[model samples]
Target: MKYQIRHRTHYRYTQPLRSAVQTLCLTPRHTDTQHVHHWQLQSPTPLQPQTDAWGNHSHVLAVGAGARMLQCEATGMVETLGTPLQSDPLGPDPRLYLMPSALARADDALRRSALAAVRGVEGRQAQALALTALVAECVRYQPGRTNANTTAAEAWLGGVGVCQDQAHVLVAACRAVGLPARYVSGYFHARGGPELASHAWAQVCLDPAERRWLGLDVTHGCVVDERHVQIAVGPDYAACAPVRGVRSGGGGEQLTVSVEIIPQD
Candidate 1:
């Protein structure tokens, strides 16, 4: 399956009188399961392409003084070619994912939750599925209840969050159970089905010897397949945020993002 993805972000500031710098992780990666056909980015400022510590393709955008309204757009075509379940995992230190970040911190509550979810699950894949389902039940998909900085324990207790929070909870729970899991930011192409501009999921290292990672979408309670286009992977959302920036002077900024993923013929 091939998908044409478009993501647009607009920033409106109440007062702007200086410069801005941003880092973007909007480019799809070349993995065993997916390939980037063509990609392009549009921003008011020039972008310097660079790869991050986790091997994600990133761009650094810098805008000069006197910039009020800023817009960043990314358009690309990605082909999901192979079986995601059988896909070869990219060689990275799995321990990095096992280590918890602030946003994915785990505690006694999460550990108990993990133990409960994996009870009687025989294999890693089965445990992953069970945990995904548990997370789906634990966290209702409710926006505005949490923000990007929401921790896994917070979301687990709150029982309501968006995909990011759900993914964080799943990641934390997997780590608690000694399964290496990471956060994945991507686009989901629904192929004339329900439309979502962008999405987040969790990936677990099920087989260390085989170097295979299982992708699970806790939000949708399904295994990630060709419909998923992965862009970045990290311990949590903070490391893989699509856009992060520092500005000298921009007050009371409002951000709006629009995303579209259309299947290509």
Candidate 2:
């Protein structure tokens, strides 16, 4: 399947910002399951492209003084293989994902729930699926209840959050049981109502030696498929956020994001 994706983000601030520097992870990743044909980014300033420590394609955008508004757009074409399970022969060591990040640290209650979910599961894939179901059941998809900084422990305890929270809980749960799992940020093409085009999921490493992984969408309680396009993989959402920046001075800001994923074929 081929897709044309457009993502636009705009920011309005009450006060002009003196200066700002942003890190962007908006580019889709070239992996065994997907191939990037062409990708372009448009911003107020020039973008410096670089690969992050986790091998994700990223960019650095710098804005000078007296900026009251900021807009960034990304357009791309990609082809997906529609394979939910894949092996990353050239990715970072799978062991690196075993330790949960701060935003995905599992608490004692979470650990116990994870253990009970996979207690009788046999294969790694089955256990991962069980965990995915557990996350979906434990965390109802409720937007506005959690923000970007919400942690897995908090979301699980509250039992309400969006896809990001679900992914964090899944990653934390997988790591609690000695399985290596990484957070995935991407785009999802939904056929109908309410689901955001911008999505998040988890990829569990089944065989570290073989670099085999299974992509799980805890929000939908299923494996990732052709509708999903990979963007970045990291320990948590903070590491793979589409855009993160700091400015010298910007009082009260409002942000708007629009994402469109059209099927080309």
**Per-candidate count of clashing residue pairs (backbone under 3 Å):** 0, 0
Q: Model 1, 30: alpha-carbon shift in Å? A: 1.3
Candidate 1 segments whose C-alpha is farther than 4 A from its true place: 86-91
| Candidate 2 Cα errors over 4 Å, as ranges | 192-195
User: Weakest 10 consecutive residues, lDDT, candidate 2?
Assistant: 188-197
Q: 93-142 in candidate 1: lDDT tens per residue?
A: 77677888999988898889899889888988888888888899889999
- The local distance difference test score of model 2 is 0.91
Best by the lDDT measure: 2
Q: What would the TM-scores of all predictions be?
A: 0.93, 0.95
What TM-score does model 1 achieve against the real structure? 0.93
Which clashing pairs does model 1 show?
A: none
Error of 2 at 194 (Å): 7.6
Q: Residue-wise lDDT of candidate 2 within 1-265, one digit each (tens)?
A: 8988899999898998989899989998678888999999999998999988777889999998899999999999999998998787656899999887999999999999999999978988889989998999889999999999999999999999999999999999999998999999998876554445689999999999999889999887679898889999899999989999788887989999998888886
Q: Candidate 2: lDDT of 164?
A: 95
